[model samples]
Target: MESQSSLQRLLSGPIAPGELAWIGLRPARRASMIPVSAAKLAPGEGLEGDHYISSRNGPRQVTLIAAEDLAAIGQFLAGAGAQPEQLRRNLVTRGVNLLALKDRRFSIGPVILEGAGECAPCGRMEETLGPGGYNAVRGHGGILARVIEGGEVRLGDPIERIEEDISTVLARRRNR
Candidate 1:
């Protein structure tokens, strides 16, 4: 047995679980996102009814945003909290640091997703959220992920990190 370094321990520390607060699906490009209580996730494909689908897995198989971030975006403009659909993200989560999921494997119920990168806000935000919309979402756009294991993701499903830190993984690789 060996003692762990403080930084390593901190990186591997526990994260409080969060629940899936909302779900939205875009039926087609430029279509209004429809709020849904549940949706099916298919590996290599996106949400069953959502338009952003492909035969092969991609970085943006699905997109998610934090509920807190949405509120922050709203505060930037006249105390108007934008709706989940207005953000154009596939899911809206609450009570969790979504950045923690970046570059890590996390699970939403039985569905597994590997955080691909930051879900940068698109120019469309201006049109969707009104004035200053794009700037409002600048640092709070949430994250995008690729589905590694597919299953149903329903509202109220628990979201939890189920993997080791990427730093630990990189260290192991370097040592080997």
Candidate 2:
């Protein structure tokens, strides 16, 4: 019998489900984000009508931020927290730790997304949030994801991790 690796077990830890609290999309590069109640996620492309729409699929098809982190950022910035639109993430999630989703597949409503990478803060953060904006968002910037199964996601949707069996996780880790 194959023994379970501690690393794989740790990676499979359970997380409390979160909620999709907000949605925002930019029609063009450097454009102001438009808040929406619902949005369609296109597999291999991106959010419909968003500037990230493309023919090829890649990391960063979607961006997300934790609402708690937003509050933390507000506290860091002398209580002047930026809004979801100003932060420019496609989805604003609450009650879940974004860092815990790294390298895992998760779902928001019917849409599935794979953790891709960190959403690094851009130089525009300074312009968007005033002085120290870039620094303020450094660790609180959120995460990037690739759409796996595209579908419509709406505000108040539940964010749940797609748990994999221990054997499957071990096999994948071994292969890596």
TM-scores for the candidates = 0.86, 0.88
lDDT of 2: 0.87
lDDT (0 to 1) per candidate: 0.87, 0.87
lDDT of 2 by residue, 50-149 (tens): 9988744788889999999889878878999888887889999999999788778888997878888889999988888889888889899899998877
Alpha-carbon RMSD to native, per candidate: 6.0, 5.5
RMSD over all Cα atoms, model 1: 6.0
lDDT of 1 by residue, 1-176 (tens): 89999987887688999999999998888898899999999877778888888533688889999999999898997798888888889999998899888888888987888889999988999999998999999989999998877889999999999766645644664586
The candidate maximizing TM-score is: 2
Off by over 4 Å in 2: 1-7, 165-176
Which residue segments of model 1 deviate by more than 4 Å?
A: 1-8, 164-176
